[model samples]
Each structure stands twice: as structure tokens, then as C-alpha cells.
Target chain A: MADTVLEVRDLSLEYRSRRGPVKALRNVSFDLYKGETLALIGESGCGKSTMGFALIRLTPGTAKITNGNVTFVDGPNRINLMEMSENEIRRFRWTDMAMMLQAALNAYNPLIRIQDHFIDTAKAHGLNNKSEIIARARRLLTGVQLDADRVLPAYPHELSGGMRQRVLLALGLLMQPKIIILDEPTTALDILTQRSIIELLRKLKDEFNFTMIFISHDLSLAAELADRVATMYAGQIVELTDVFSAFEKPRHPYTFGLTRAVPTLHGAVEKLESIPGSPPDLVFMPSGCKFHPRCPFATDKCKEVEPKLTAYGGHQVACHNWQQVLEESQKAR
Target chain B: MALLELKHITKQFRQGKKVVTAVDDVNLAIQDKEIICLVGESGCGKTTTGKMAAGLLDQTSGQILFEGKDISKLSGPEFMAYRRSVQMVHQDPFSSLNPVRTIYQTISAPLLYHKFAKDERDARRRSIEILEMVDLTPAEEILDKFPHQLSGGQRQRVSVARALTVNPKFIVADEAVSMVDVSIRASLLNMLRRLNQELGVSFLFITHDLALAKYFAWEGRVGVMYTGRMVELSRSPSLIEKPLHPYTAALMSAIPEADPRLTRSKERIVLRSDDIPSLTKLPPGCHFHPRCPVWLEGKCDKVQPILTEMGPGHQVACHVAFDITGGGSKISAGTR
Candidate 1:
């Protein structure tokens, strides 16, 4: 809650489709504090990944940012990322803000050795010294608990999925960016491997103190790593609160449903109720609230008029029936 | 009597020259209307075991007995009967359902082939009934829709309905609900649970998730797999509460639950190594010994341990778990 590193305001994006423009992001607004991890949790097609791409201006050609701005702050310098020219933004990226895309194992060139990747990244960022790049890469790879000697000369395909993910993580931190956006970092990993990655991430965060935007659908990842949590549904931030508040006292019905839907590894066995229906179609979204059709507490107002995010107690929630949801959650407890 | 029994089943695949032992002498006996979940990481042979159990894949050795009859020895109608009685619902609903076929066609094919339906008219009626069984409302409308038109959850439900068309006595669902969204996963699981109870169909639910395995098999049993071997088997609650095998304990400890305070505060059982041993060149003795925290170096790395009964309905394949010597003390000291 101190020193805002990144401020995203009214960010909207749409993808060109034959049916129409698919509104992927709608009025997404959040502030990422320095040295804190903000997890953006959502199901597929909820624009969580899109928001990560939009933050670094790395979305596909079909996607167009319709409105809004991202302000990157570093000490006395404050720059609007959206207003920067293509070359300026290109230079600004990786050096100031880095993004580790989902399934980054495939992002590497299969022909090149791991060392070449570090060299290429360093050269792109204007760090030309070969010895310096190798030294930095060695430090990062060792820090991630990998043997740099074995990993450096091997191709991406030679490494296992977990090792490849760690290589990517090490590569992402090479430039020492102030902000790191990791998209589904531990997805597709085994339970033990995921735990190791989570532990490594926590250790790295503590050591580096870099602001992080962790995007994942797995609630466990958020519970373990996030300082703050954002629940995204239908291209909108439905809820934003501290990690403890979001899990223990969720204001939004979607968040509550998500928490209840997942069967925890421990604790008393309880009946879990899945939310009815699927995610809304992006091109032809439902009227009013996008989640109303599936919400158990939906009413006429919810079906007709969408609710804006309103501060309640200590967190922000975009729901017409937060009080009722709170009451229901408390009653269950 | 056991509905389906897999006795010392071993499946091997030839990757060019080297033989990959996918499933290594895994033994299991599934009771009538029982739910047994096989859980492990990728390439741990859970899927291969499921495929063998479903009668789709032939094991290199060992016997699969359906109703106490050797499935491999069955001929003509007997083989056909075994095939029809055991069905498989795959992990991906998108690819599993034929894109060209409508829900009605997919459902009716199995019914007509198996002679479960009297005529086309009867097949249509039965199709609707089966669709409704999976909670797909207005079965009439859903029957006309193609796989691409339905959501992931809906397509999965349609796949289940198709599997149910044959009236299978046993079902092998391999990561059945993993592809669907988290919010709809419980509904799919609940539907499966209901079918198991109401239809009296036994299930071999295979998944990588320990939590899902525990939830779905709470009343039945859970088996833990590592490198093509069954390392541990027990009732769900006891298995979760007190995992016997070091691998199972590591898996149980590694899982981060969907709770803030609990997950953060929970102690992790760190493995000695993170890499899973390759099936082609597996370690000499216990495949898990390389990564196991409580592994006895001289004993575990030399002689492979078989499933040894620890208690009532509980079995673990680890020398340290039984502790012929002082291995239990090392387990307590190494993990925390």
C-alpha cells in the first residue's frame, strides 16, 4: 500500500472478429504497489492474460486498445506507457517492466542453447558485455536452484517442463525490472514442482522486492503467493482486496463461488456447489451484469443494470448483492 | 465379488528400440459400485492403467478380470460384452467428441451398436433419457447441437451421456473434469458421483490432483502412483491424513490448498531431487528413492519394495514406511 509502481485506469481492449469486436478488457483499473504481489485470478477468456499483455503493449495485431492509460512510476519519473512511441515502448519494456507469458517453455527457440537466450536478451537490452551477461545469468540460474553449467549449453527441449519454466523465470529477471508480470507460472507443473516454484518465487520476491502481477486461474497459487487478489469475470475486475479478505470474506459472489468450488487438500469434507452455466460469450455478452445469468442471488436489478465497483468495509467489489452474499457466507460459517 | 480386477498388470511400449515400462506390475481389485482414484504426475502411468482397465490398451503381462473372468481369454460375444460393459471418458472433451457428430448421433451409435435400443425411435427416446440423466436440460434441443456449439462443460456432459448409452457396469474417467472451468468442475463431479450411486456403475477415476482424488473417492479408496508403480493404497481419509509412502506424503505436503492461512503456514516436505526419473532408464530399485526424503540409500536404491500391508485396507511400497530399522526417525527429521 505504499509507492504505486503501476497504475492501470479504465483500460479497455477489443479483438477484431467476424461476429463483431470481442471486448476482451473493459474498464480494468488497479494499482500495483511496489514490493507486493497482486494476483489476477479468473477463468479462461476472462481477460486476465489479455490485461498482462496490454500492460506491456505486447498483444496480438487483432487486439486494439480502445481507451485508458497505464502509468509507470519510478521515483520522480512518471511515464504514460500508452502514449510512448513504438520504439520508445520497445526500449522501455524488459528494461523497466518484464512479462513472463503463459507456457513460456515454447517461447524459446528450440535451436539455440540456454546461454544464447540470455545473451540475446542482454544484447537486446543494450547490455553488450558477454562475460557480464554470463555472470548475471549464472547468478539468476543458481538463485533459482538450477545448475547453470548444465542448463546453459542445453537446448530448451532438452530441459524438463519445470526446468524450462525456471529458465524462463531466470531469463525474465536478467534485466532486473522493477515490475514482473507472470502468467500462470506454475500451471502444467506437478504438485511437488509447483510447490518448489512457489517457494522459489517467494524467496526471490523477498530478496529482490520487485512488484509482481501474478495471473492464474488456480486459487491455490493466489492463496500461497498473492498479497492482494483481483477476481476477473467477463473482462471486468469483479473484486479487488487483500488476500486474507478476498478468501475469508469475499464480497463478490463469483469469488465466493470460486472459493467454495475448489476442494481443499485439507480440512473437513464439505459439499461443494459449482456455479451453474459457463462463461459468457465475449462478442455477444449478456445485458447488465455478465454473471447474473449464473448467479444464485441474481435479481431483476442485476439482470437490467450492471453494478460498479463500490468500496465496502475494506475492499472493492462490483456486485449488487454484496451484503446478501456476506450474510450468506457468514451464515454458512 | 470384485467387478473388475487388475492382477500384476504391466504395460510396455517400444519407443524405437528401448522398451518403456509404462505400468509395472500394478495390482488392483475394484469392488462393485466402488470408486477408486489413481493419482500421480504426468507419465506416471495412471492414464495407461486406465486405458488397460477400459480394455482399450493391451498390457504386456498380467490379467484383467471382468466379473472374475480373464478378459484376455474371452472370445466372440464374451470379449464384446467386456468391451461394451467398460467405457472410457477421456480428459479432453473437445477432441473426445467427434466434431461432425451431433449429440443425438453420438449417443445413439453406442446404443444401436450394442443393441441397447429396439429401433431408431427407441434410440431417440433413450438418447433423450440419457441426456437428461447428465442434467442437460431440454434434451431434445441439446440432441441437435454439435460438439463445437456446446460449452466445455456441456460437451463433457454429452461425452458422459454417450458413455452411459451402453449402460457400462464400469467407467474409467481419466482427468474427466480437469478441462472444465473451476466453477463448473464441481457440477460435473457431482453428476459423476450421482451416476455412480444411482446407476450402480463402478468408477476408476484417474487424476493428477490429490484434492480431487480425495474428494471423489472419500467413501471408496485412493491409490498413489510413481514411475509406473503403485506406491500406496488406502481409504481416502486415512491416506490423506497419514500418508505412508514418502512419495504420497511429499505429494500431500506439496499441495497448496485453497486457503490463505493454511497454505502459507503448512509445512512442505521437500524432495531430495525435483526431477522425475525417466521410465526408460528407471533407477535400479525404487524409482522414487532418488527424490524421496525418507529413502534408505543402501536398501531402497538396491532392492525394489513391493506393496506391504500396513494396516486394515492400507498398503505402502516402501521399506522405510514399515521401518525394519530406524527409518521412521529419519522420516520425521528429514521432512520438517
Candidate 2:
């Protein structure tokens, strides 16, 4: 509904393995709207993190983007990231977009003070005035509810896990980028710490109005943060819809199964039904639908024909038997 | 009689010059086929308590009784028997399984050592039976594969199978399913529940996830720990619904539910501080007092509170909770 800030068209990537190419992403297409949080939710090895890395063109050496066009649009200027030179992309990275990686402890150098990380990032983005950089970093540290005085001078190991995560968040916002991608930011933190971080993110989003792509396996975080959710399974976008529709009326069976698998903290304890099988191997994938091996409503057609992501009403789902899935999900409620 | 019991369990570790009390004055008794989940944040001593229960680590001051005999005082054969009856399933399936050993070699070693199987042929048969019991299908195919060949869930099942090799009466599963995928977690928990039901093996399950604790130990009991103390212990469903301790209530209110509407609308208990204090420099009196929302100034900071019975089968350790719950009728008598 809002302005489209980034468009990914037919994006596909693969990892060069000893056996063969591991198809990590397959024909994934999506539009990221300005000032909206789009959550990429999936289990492990579902290419959610790969999608993040691919967006910034910072994928590992073994990863090769085979086919894709990533266009970044701001006002009248349209720039295809795939066409950018290595030097140009480096200059465009922190100023236009930034990615906060997982495990903040590992993100920072153990020997350096927190201020150095901020200063180095700012300098790389061509901001050489040391005092100005320190002032901005202090402001962000305080904005994240950390004591700027104590945190700015301490090493990464000296700070707690939650504090380190907050520092990383502050550093991501140091250049004041319009788009930020966070990968499993709160995975290992305590519940109270997670709540505080969620609250802080909400506050930051309201104040800054920056577009965010949150990558996490935790469904509750996605439910609390995202405007729209894309369920990734076996290196493909299986379902894409509004957060409400994604949870209340998930059309794809894998999305439905994921919503049912997690137990809620406050609710009637119902018998949870887990997805029947494990995720498919990326190198030697099964034919037809990637999720067909675990789908209860899978038919003979599903085994032979690959279903494309088709729009029905307002949402998109890649499933042949979605009507039956909708009916059964409604009945379960 | 209880199958296993830990009385006044206290574990202290010497780190450089300072002595860190990892677990302090904890008491628990698990009966036959009972499931008691210990839920807490990291550095809260849940794992240390579990290791003590499994006899993997010795408690500095405590009594671990297996079949009414103290484990520390047991003779060589008696200690071996105690070790056989109690097993541990660690958190990381990747590192817990020996990388070099094949699945058959790892599982059969315990069977042959404890003489659960008569010979090598018998050991192979028993290993397959145990692997099949944990639902690792095509057991014959899996036996020859090394740990790296299996998925995380498969490796965890192998771990469970290895724990089951000795036919343990009590298994201490410390965050057993945390490392697996969300879809796989439920099935693994279901398999563990099935083991509890069919084999009559009790468990001391440990995890930081309250939702998972509620799901796994719904029919059993849940214990809430903070720092190195047991703050609350009660039946699972009630403990989740009507938590008495402030820490437990804070954790319950703070956790985000999977539902969109429920998670957003739920009220939260904001703590005084977010940082969990270090073990070496723990605050005096109650370990949670510094961050407690309902802390008493003079009493809570001056005196530690022991577990007191608030209602039927419910135990809480807090001065404010004790006051709010009518000051209790009796102190917990060290038996669940």
C-alpha cells in the first residue's frame, strides 16, 4: 500500500558444494515497502539469512547469486544493486542500508572499546570528525536505554548479552540508514531482555520510521514486530500476507503447521501437531512442492506438479490444495 | 519412596581467587515416572543442579540419595549402580555425541559396559531396539553413520537412545530440545513424554523457555529458579496460570506468546533492572531482590527466604509472596 523502496525479482542463489550446487534460494520475489517491517520467518537453513546477505551483496565467497535483479528506489532515483561496482557498493552500504548480524559478541572485536566500533564504521562511511561521531554514538546508546557513559568505553565481553545486542542496534543506526536488517537479534537473550528490546524497537520505529527486514525463527517476535510476514521453506517463499492474515488464516500448509507447532504462554493447552518430516536437503531436493513430504493435504498432483505463488484475494500462497487447507484451518479454530 | 532426591544441595566452584556458589540450598524429590522441569535464565544454576542430580558433578554440601542411600557415601559397585540408574542428556547434540564414533559404537558401548547386552551381536540388536524406540526410523541405516551425517533432530534422538541404553530410572534432560527446529521440537517432546509414560522413567527437565516447560511438563511439575535458588515449585498448569512468586510472574508476563493479539495485549511486569547480577558478586540476602518489582526494602535485602507452602503442592520463596499469601501454614519439608 505504501511506496515500494526495494524490489527483488526472480532472485536465485546457490552455494558451490563438493557434491553439487546447493540451491539456497529459488525464484524469490518480493517488494519491501518504505517504513514497514517485513519479517522473514522460517526454521534453520531455510535461506532467510541468505536472503539478508544477498540483499546487501555481502554473501559468503562460496555463495553465488545466479539470477536476480535487486532495485533500490528512492524518490525518482532508481539504482539496480546488481549493477553496482564493488567500490560503489562499499560506499553505498552503511549510508543507505546496514545489516546488524547475529551474535553481537562475535560482531565486535574483543579488544576494542565500543566507541572504536562506532568511530570506525562512521569513518568508513566518510565521516572523519571524531567528536561528532562520538556524540552521535552516545545519543544512540542512550536512546537504546543503555548508560552511554558505562557502555561506550567497555569491551564487548564486559557487557552482558542484552547490552551487547543493544550496542549492535545502536551501531546499526549510527549512520542513520533508511533500511536495517537484523538477523536473529534476540535469539539467546533472556525473556525480560527480549521484552525490553522489543519495546525499544517499537519506540525506534515510531521515531525513525525506517524500513526493517527482521529475520528470525521465533514466531512470537515476528508476530509482535512485523507488518507483513513471508514464510520461507526450503529456499522459497511459500506464503506472503499481512501479519493478521498470516497468523489467523494461513493459506499455505507449512505456514499453518508452523503456527500450530509453537505453544503459547497464555492459552488453553491444546494438542499441538508438528510437521511430520524434516526439511529437505538443499542439494538434492525432492520434486514438486518442497513441503509436500510433510503436508497432510498433499495429493498426487502435488507430488508431480510444482505450484507457483498465486494470489488469492489479498495474500499470496504457493500451494495446490490451499482451499482445503483454509477450510480445515477454519474448522480447527 | 522417591526414586531420587537432592537434599540441601549447594555447589561452589573456585574461579581464580573467588568462590562462586553455583547452586545454593536447593531441595527436590522426584518420584517414580514424575517429570519436574527446572526453568530459569542462564547462570541461574539450572544446569548445575541437573549435573548434581545426575552425579556428573559433586555438590560441595548436599546429599544426593538414590533409593534412600547417599551417593557420596556409596561404595564402588554401589556408585556404579547409581550412575547406571541415572543418565544425562545434554543440551548440544552436536558436541554431546562423539564426532568420531559411529551411532552403533556410541550406543552399544553403554549396553556392553553395563551388560544390558550379553555380546557384540546382542549389543547391536539392543542398540537398534533403543534407536527404534526413540523413533529414529531405519535404525539399521543410521547405525553405521557418524554424528556429522545426521541432522540435529536425528542426533538428539541418538542422544536419547544413548541415555536409554542403560535403562536409566531417572534422566536429567538439560535443554534437550532447544537446539532443534521448532517443528521438530514438538515431536521430540512427544517422544520424551512417550518414554515417560511407557518406560516409567522420571525426568528433571531444564530449560529457559516457559512455554516449552508448560508444554512438556503439563501433567507433571514446574520449578522456577533465579540466581541459585528455587523461587517457586508447583504443578505445571497452575504454576503457569497462577504464579505466586514475583520472579515467576515477571517471567510469565514478560514472555511473548505466539499469537499476535495475545502477545501485544498482554500486560507486563517491568523489573527494576534488566541486568542479571554476576554469580561471583551476587547481592546479599535474596538473589533477586535487586531486580525484583515487589521488593521489600529492609527485609528482602537483609534476610533470605526459603521455600514455603502457599497452597496445595505449591512452594514459593519470597518475603512479599509469603506476606501476600497469608504468611504460609508450613515451611516445605524437603519432599515433593
Encode model 2's per-residue lDDT on B1-336: one tens digit a residue.
789999999999999999998898999999999999999999999999999999999899979899999988999999999999999999999999999999999999999989999999999999999999999989999999999999999999999999999989999999999999998888999999999999999999999999999988999999999888899999998788788887888888888887888888777777888888899998988888898877789999999999988788889998987776443222111111
- DockQ (CA atoms), all models: 0.87, 0.82
CA displacement after TM-score superposition, residue A269 of candidate 1 (Å): 1.2
Q: Estimate each model's TM-score.
A: 0.98, 0.97
Task: Give candidate 1's TM-score.
Answer: 0.98
Which ten contiguous residues of candidate 1 chain A have the minimum total lDDT? A324-333
Pairs of residues at least 3 apart in sequence or in different chains that clash in candidate 2: none
Model 2, C-alpha of B228: deviation from truth (Å): 0.6
B1-336 in candidate 1: lDDT tens per residue?
699999999999999999999999999999999999999999999999999999999999999999999997898999998888899999999999999988889999989988999999999999999999999988999999999999999999998998999889999999999999999999999999999999999999999999999889999999999999999999898888777788887887788888999998877777889988898889988888888877777999999999988877888899888874433334534566
lDDT score, residue B121, model 2? 99
Model 1, A1-333: lDDT tens digits are 599999999999999999999999999888888899999999999999999999999999999999999999999999999999999988888889999978967779999999999999999889999999999999999999999999999999899989988999899899998999999999989888898899899899888878899999999899989999999999999999999989988879999999999998888888889988889999999999999999999999999999998787659999999989978877765
DockQ of candidate 1 (2 decimals): 0.87
